[model samples]
Target: MASHRRPTHSGLTHSARVTVLSAAAATAVAALGATPAGADPQTSPERARAAVDRLFQEAEKATERFNSASERATHLREELGQVQDGVARGQERINRLREALGSLAGAQYRSGGVDPTLSLLLSSDPDTFLAQAEMLNMVTERQHSALQDLQRAQRSIGQLRTEAARDLSDLERSRAAVARHKRTVERKLAQAQRLLNSLPSEERGAFDRASRSGRGVLPAVSGDAPASSRAAAAIRAARSAVGRPYVWGANGPSGFDCSGLVQWSYAQAGVGLPRTSQAQRYAGRQVPLSEARPGDLVTYRNDASHIGMYMGNGQVVHAPYPGASVRYDPVRMMPISAVTRV
Candidate 1:
């Protein structure tokens, strides 16, 4: 049976980064799946947009994770190298001790070069010879102690060798794991880059005009500061749970894991996204980022591994991982992946 595994948002799919043509193109409509025209489009579009931008941003964030893993792998390998060196040195000490013990046992002791039983029996003073025999017993005890120490050193060297071997195996696995993560991150970055590249330069003006249609006659992107709106308000609601801690598979206004928070936020906005980041990113519309809005979903890391909600101003609301709460972050920190306007 397969153990439930934690989802790792690392990189992207090979073809994830394709571009889009127009903001109102069929892809956008398909992604949104809700018209801004009637019947709760106003409420629903906000949710859809939030989901899309979150997917893109999460995909982009994979790159940061990939880089961090790479550095960690490198450090672990280095530490493993040092451990192996210690093992080697331990072996050398054992060998030297063994040699010293062997030589001492062979040359420093004999059945009795001077205090031989034959010599003792022939001695004129057997009493004095008995004292010398007692001294020989002391020498034998010292030799035994030295031999035991040599034996102990050999055992210790053997244990160190085994430990070093295990460390090397662990280090190799870590390095491979990091490589997989890098591949994931690259995939997301490529996807984000691809989506951004999809729109023609001429479409920029059209999106800018559309973005300005909201109430109060907002200024253009050139000098406009990001403003709060219903979408932003909804995102703020999502961000409120930051620091509440993540619990996988739990969706709560109190605390949430990554997908749970995303799922709950969309639920609040009156739309439903997939329960997982990968599935969520898969269902959204292929958007030219120029069409991205404050509430759009952003996915980051590879394979739509992690996700966040867009809050404009280059920020996101996401439950990053276990022990973490939903928080706002710069969208650039993530891959800026394809914006799926829900």
Candidate 2:
């Protein structure tokens, strides 16, 4: 009867195979049950690094917004001050015009309500009175001019007052935005610090050492420095700040962000650059990376959140990130969006 044919495969009977499979499944379940804690070793560190990077990126975006709002508020304050001054001057001119008009009315009343010109024509000293009449004619012309000026000043004062009010309103809104951005940055940075603190001591040490290592040093000035005086000066200035701390919105000898470093370095060269990376990207003539010269700003990331000053020889000086200082990195540290010659 074909041995009631329980087929055999791999030299095992069907019953034997079934038993083996059951035992294997049970063993797998047991092994899974006995699995140790933290079986996957890579997850925590990877997640921590990714979280830190994400938080830092968010903080940077908020920092830029804060910087922009701060700059706008400053400009608005200056403009409002000028407008208020103009309004004060307009009021003064209006008062002067009123006083002149009053003087003219008083002279007419003193002339017995008759025309001053008629008084001049009937005077005994006719030639002398004629000279005085000429003077009076000049005064009359001046008074008419003052009246027109007064009307114009009044209109100007109205417009200036309106502008001043609008500027104040805008400034208040900008201040609110700045505050919001500041809060966002602080929260993100705090979260990042917490994530970083969670990293193992060895991993944290490695990360810190990496930041302090290779690329953070100043780049050597190559012989290929651009011939442009301003560009060379800017490059020199940027290089001089290689070890400065990174401070959001600072354009200074103390600390700087990416665009702040660029702006401040250019300022040292007597060149004016825009405040933010986005604006600075368009502030100068854009050039191809291959054609980039010393002092050209190399903007990174599609959003233009990062920038660095080209220091010739394929190196750039940049304020890399929060924990990193102003340093030299390869021009290809990140994706290059633009190279602008300021």
Q: Which candidate leads the pack in lDDT?
A: 2
> On residues 49-139, what C-alpha lDDT tens digit does candidate 1 reach at each position?
3333443344434533443455566677787788778778877887877787777566645644454556667878978889967876776
What's the distance in Å from true for residue 146, model 1?
1.5
| Per-model root-mean-square deviation over C-alphas | 16.2, 14.2
lDDT at position 42, candidate 2: 25
lDDT of each: 0.54, 0.74
Can you write out model 2's per-residue Cα lDDT over 119-198, one digit (the tens) per residue?
78888997889799999999889878878887888888899889989999998999899899899988888876765564
Worst 10 residues of 1 by lDDT: 1-10
Off by over 4 Å in 2: 1-41, 110-142
